[model samples]
Target: MLAAKRMFSLAVADTDLFLEMPSSTQALYFHLGLRADDDGFVSSPKKIAKICGCGEDDLKILASKHFILPFESGVVVITHWLLNNNRIKSDRYKQTLYIAEKSMLEVENGVYMFTGSRMYPERNQNGDITEPQIRLDKSREEKNRVNNNGRKTSRFTPPTVEEVQEYCSERGNAVDAQSFVDFYISKDWYIGKNKMKDWKAAVRTWEKNQRQKNKKSKDDEGLEGWLNA
Candidate 1:
C-alpha cells in the first residue's frame, strides 16, 4: 500500500545531484515519492516507468549519484527516505521488503549508512541511550483490526497506477487510471464513507461508468444529426 503522505525535503534543492539532473530524472523521482511504501522502497521499476513515462536510464542515473540504491532483487531504496520523512509509530508502520534486500544491498556496495542507528530514537527510563522500544498500544491495534461496521480490516493492497492502467487497457476502456488513483489516494484509500474493501471493484465501476458515458454521447450526436436531416 502507498503511504498516506510523504515529505519532500527542501534540502534536496541544495544538493548537486538535484541541480544537475535532467527533467526526466526529476519527474521520475517525484513519481517514486508518490508510489513508494512507508519505508521508501519502490518494488518494480518497469511498472513505474510504464505509469510515469520515465525510462530505466533515470533509475541508473539516480543510483549512480547515490540518490538511490538499486538491488539485484529489482528493488530501489531511496537513500534519503528516512532523512526526509518523519518517523511513523511502530505499530502503524508496515514492514518493508527491505529487510531481505538489505543484505544484498550491502554486498552490492549499496549505501545503508543508518543501519542499527537511531532512525526512531527513544530514551530509556534512566534517560540514557537505549534501543528504541516498539510501543504497540493494544486498544489502537484492536481498533485497526476491526472497522466501525465490525468487519475485519481489509488486507487489500492498493494497486499502482500502472496496474490500473493495464486493467483498464485490457477492457478497452479509456478510463484515466492515474486520476482514479489520485482520487482514492487523496481520500486515504476510502470510498465515499468507508475504507475501500476492494480496489478492483472500484476500477470496474470506473470502466463501466466511462463506457456508458461515451456510448450516450455518441448516441446523442447521431440523434441530433438525424433530426436536423
Candidate 2:
C-alpha cells in the first residue's frame, strides 16, 4: 500500500522559453493542468478552468502552448525523454517517493529491500510505498505468543533426586566448578533468595511439627517419625 508519494525535480527553467510564452501561458503552467504520480497521472481541465477562473478556451490555448503533460497514454516515455534532457529543471523530474507494502518485491535505484506478503493497500506499480513490513512483523509476534503455551510460570519446580543423579553422572564425579552458580541461577534448582532463607523456613516447619509431636494427637508426629519412635 502506498501511504504517500512525492515527485521531486526542478521545474523547467530557461529564460528563452519563458520569453517565448505569453503571461497567460506562463500562468497556466503556474496553475498546472495536471498532477503526476509514480505510476500514473491525472488532470480535470474543467475543474482547473473553474478554479483558476480560466475560460475553457483559455485552458485549451494554454495546454496547447505549454505541452502540459496529461494522464493520457505515451506520457511516460515523453517524461523520460524530457528528464534525460538538460534543458528542463523541475525538481519533480528526477526522483519520487512511494510508501508501499512491506511485502512488495521492489528494485529501487537497483537495490532490493522489502520482501514478503501484503494487505490493506491495493497493489499498484506506480507507488513507492509498501505495507507488508508491518504485516509480517505483527504475524511473528503473534506466532511467538501462540507457541509459548504450556510453558511454566512458577519461579521454581523442586529439583528431583533423578536430576541430581543425572548431573553427577554427566560430570563423571568431577565437579563442574560453576555448578553452584548454575544451581543458584538456573531452573535446575529453582532456588531463590539465600540458603539462610531455606533454613529459616525449614526450622519454622520443624518447630511446628515438634509441637504436634509433643501434643501426641494420634499419629500427628508424622507417620515416619512416629513409626520410628
Candidate 3:
C-alpha cells in the first residue's frame, strides 16, 4: 500500500539551506518528494526533472547542497526524507527496491545520512545545516569470519544479475548485465590476475572503456570515408 499524500517540514524549507538554492531546484525538490517512494527514494529524478521543465543543473544543485543524495545509478534520495514524512503508518509504507543504496544510508536526528564513502551533512554554530563533510576512516567491509582452521577470511561477493540490471538501469547505461556476470564468472571474478574488490567500480570501468571504443570506431569509419572520397 502507498500513502495518499506527502509532507514537508518548514524546518527544512524555511531555512537558508533551502532558500539559497535556485527556484527551479526548489520546485524540482518538491516534485521529487511528491513522487518518491515511501522510503523517499526517487528512481527517475532525470525523468522527473524533464517533466517539470527543469534542467540537469537544477538536480546537480540540489545534490551539491545536500538537499538530495545522488547515486551513480541516477537515482536520488531526499536527504531530509524521514524528517518530512515521519508520521506515515507502517502498514501503508512501502520499502524502496533500491536495497543496495538504502543499505549505505543511516538515519540521524530524523534525517537520512550516508554511511559509506560519501560526504555527510552537519550543522554549524547558527543551527543551520551546512554542506557535507567528508566522512573519513570508514570501512565498508561486508563481513569477516574465522574458518574452521581459525584462519580469518573476507571474500568479495559478486552482485546478482538483477542487481546489475537495476544499477545499470539507474545509471542509464546500456551495459549487458548478464554478459558482465558471465565474463567475470569465467575469470573466477579476477580482474587482471587480481581479485575484484568492487563490482560497481568494474561496471563503471567497462562503461568508460566501451564509450572510448565506440568513439574510436566512429572516428576510424570517418577517416576511411574521407580516404575513399
Candidate 4:
C-alpha cells in the first residue's frame, strides 16, 4: 500500500512511504508532513489531504483523536508525537473516506503557492530586497492572537512580577517554595540584572495590598452580621 511516486500526485499514497502499513491515512501523516521542520507546524489540510488522496471529513474525524490540530483559516498542525508515535485506527480512516470530499481547499495545485504569486511557500525565504517580485505584498501584523468565536483578537495582558511570585507560592504547597521560585525564574518570569530583588519586592507589595483589602472586607462584613449571629 505504501507506494511512493517519483513525483507527487496529490494522492494519499504518493507521499506516504509506509503506505501499505495498516491504516494508510496514518502513514500519510507520518511521511509527507508532520514535522516541526518549517513554521513549527503544518497549516494546510488541503495539501495534506491531496497528498493523502482522502476527503476532509475523513481527515477531521481522524484529527479529532488528538492527532492533529485544525486552526483558523487553513491551519492544520499535526502534533509531533502524533505522527512519530501514535497510530491511527483503520476503522476511523475507513469511516472518513466514506464522508464528503473535504478538500484542504488551500493549495492551488499539488504545489503550494503564495496568495498572488507563482512562488511556492517554503520554510525559508532570503534574498536581496530589490529582487522581490512580490506582486502583492499583502502583509499581516505579527502578534499572539486569541481566537474568540472564530475571530482573532490581538490583545494580550502580561503578568506583573507580584502575580508571578504568588503563583509560585501557595498556601503550604507540597513543592518547596525556594525550588518553586527557582523554577519560576527559569521559566523567564524573572530576568535581567536586578531581577531577584525586584521580584521579591513585588511579591511583598502585592501581599501587603492583598492583606489590606481582605482586612477591610472583613471589617465591613463583621458589624451587622456579627451582631445578628
Candidate 5:
C-alpha cells in the first residue's frame, strides 16, 4: 500500500505470456502483479486500466493467458499468485476479502451453482431481494456521501496546482500553491502518518499561517517606521 519494495520474478518476462504481449500489455501485467495482495486479488480492473492508461482489451489479453481473471464485480484475481510472492502465515496472510472470486476460480468446468450475495443489499421479510426504501432526507444524505464513481467519496485525492491556486485566491490568502504542492508531493501527499483526509482543510491551515506571518512582518515594519519618525 505504501511505497515499499516489491519483487518481480524473471520468469514472467521469459514466459510466452509476457513475451507475446505488446509492451503496454506487458507493463500492465507487471503493474497488476505488483499491486495484487498475497492471494493475487486486485480490486476494480476498470479503475486500474484507467489509472495505467490501458484498456479493457488489455485486461482481456491477460485473462485469456490465465494470467488474471476478471469477476463480474470488476475485481481481477491474478492466477498462480502464490508461486511468486512469499508471505508469513500470520494475521496479514489470513482471510481474504475476495472469497467469492476465489470460489469462482473453481468453475473451470460448467458453472454448476452460483453463490454469494450482494454487500449491504436490501432484503424483504421473506429474505427476498428488494429495493431499499429510505426517507427522502436520508436518501439525499447517502447520495451526497458517494461520488458518481462507486468509490466512497470521502477519500482524499491530491489537488492539482490550479486547484490550490484557485482555492487560495478565493480565500484571499497569499499561500504559495507551489510550495504547498511541493511539500506534499515530497511526502506523497500524506498528512502526519496517514493519507491526507482533506486538501481544502490543509489549505485553510496554510492560509491561516500565512496571514499570521504577514501580520507579524507588517507589525515589524510599523515598529521601524515609528522609531524613525
Candidate 6:
C-alpha cells in the first residue's frame, strides 16, 4: 500500500535550483510529489497537472530542468525523491511498477540518474518532429585510462566529429557536431584555461547553454510582441 503522507526536504525546495523555476512549475512538482507512489513514480503526471490547473509547459520545464525523469510510457520519477524521503518504513514502502525504467536509473548522492540508453522523442529547432533517438549516459563510459603499453596515463583524447555526432544524436539535442568539433579543435580541446577531461561533459554543457539561449530568445520575442501590442 502507498504511504498516506509524504515529505519534502528544505534542502531541495529552498535552493536556487528549485526556487528559480516558475511558480506554476514549482506547484506542479509539489503536486506530483504528493500524488506519487512510495517509490516516487507517478504514472499519470499529465492528468495530475491538468487537475491542478498546470499545463504541459510546466511538465516540460520540470523535465528540462532535470527535476524529473520521463519515460516513454508517460511515467515520470522524481529525480530527488529519495533525497526527500529517505527513512520510510519498509512495510509501507512499495516498489515502483516501472521496473524497466527503474533499472535504467541509478542513485548518486541520493538522486536518480539515467544510466541506460533509451530512445525518446525530442523536437528540433525548426519545430519539426524527428525520429526518436537514444539518450546518452556518459557516466557509463570507462573512466580508467591506459596507454599503448597498458600503463595508466592521464591523457585527454579529443573526440572526432562522428563521435560528437553519435553522442549528440543519442542525446536528441540540436548540438551541431561539426561546429563542436571545430570549436574545440581551435581551442586545442581546452575548456577555458584547463585541458578538457571529458568531451561528453563538454557536449552536455554546450547543449545546456543552447537551451538557455533559445529560452532567452523566446522570452525576448515575447517581450517585443508585448511592447508592440
Q: Estimate the lDDT of model 6.
A: 0.76
Best candidate according to lDDT? 3
In candidate 2, which residue ranges exceed 4 Å CA deviation? 1-11, 69-229
Each prediction's total of clashing residue pairs, residues at least 3 apart in sequence or on different chains, is 0, 32, 2, 8, 0, 0
Q: After superposition, how far is residue 37 of candidate 4 from its true place, in Å?
A: 3.6
For each of the candidates, the C-alpha root-mean-square deviation to the true structure, in angstroms, is 16.9, 29.7, 11.0, 18.0, 17.2, 15.4
Q: Which lDDT tens digits does candidate 2 get at residues 168-188?
A: 466444333233323332321
| lDDT (tens digit, per residue) of candidate 4 on 139-180 | 322244558688776432223233344554753222233443
- Candidate 3, after superposition: displacement of residue 224 in Å? 38
lDDT at 139, model 4: 35
Per-residue lDDT over 1-229 for candidate 3, one digit per residue giving the tens place of the 0 to 100 score: 5576999987678777788888999999999999888888999998999999999878867765668877756788998888785457767767889999999788776778666334445676766665544343224545666899999876565565666787899988889987887567545477997988889999999899889999999999999999999
RMSD of 3: 11.0
Model 6 lDDT tens row, 32-149: 9998887789999999999999997788777755678777678999987887864478776788788998887877656776664333434456543233233544443444568789
Every model's TM-score: 0.45, 0.25, 0.56, 0.25, 0.42, 0.54
Whole-structure CA lDDT of model 4: 0.39
- Note the Cα lDDT for every prediction shown: 0.64, 0.35, 0.78, 0.39, 0.61, 0.76
Q: Predict model 5's lDDT versus the native.
A: 0.61
Candidate 3 segments exceeding 4 Å error: 117-126, 132-134, 138-229
lDDT of 3: 0.78
Better of 2 and 4 by lDDT: 4
Q: Deviation in angstroms for 227 in model 3?
A: 37
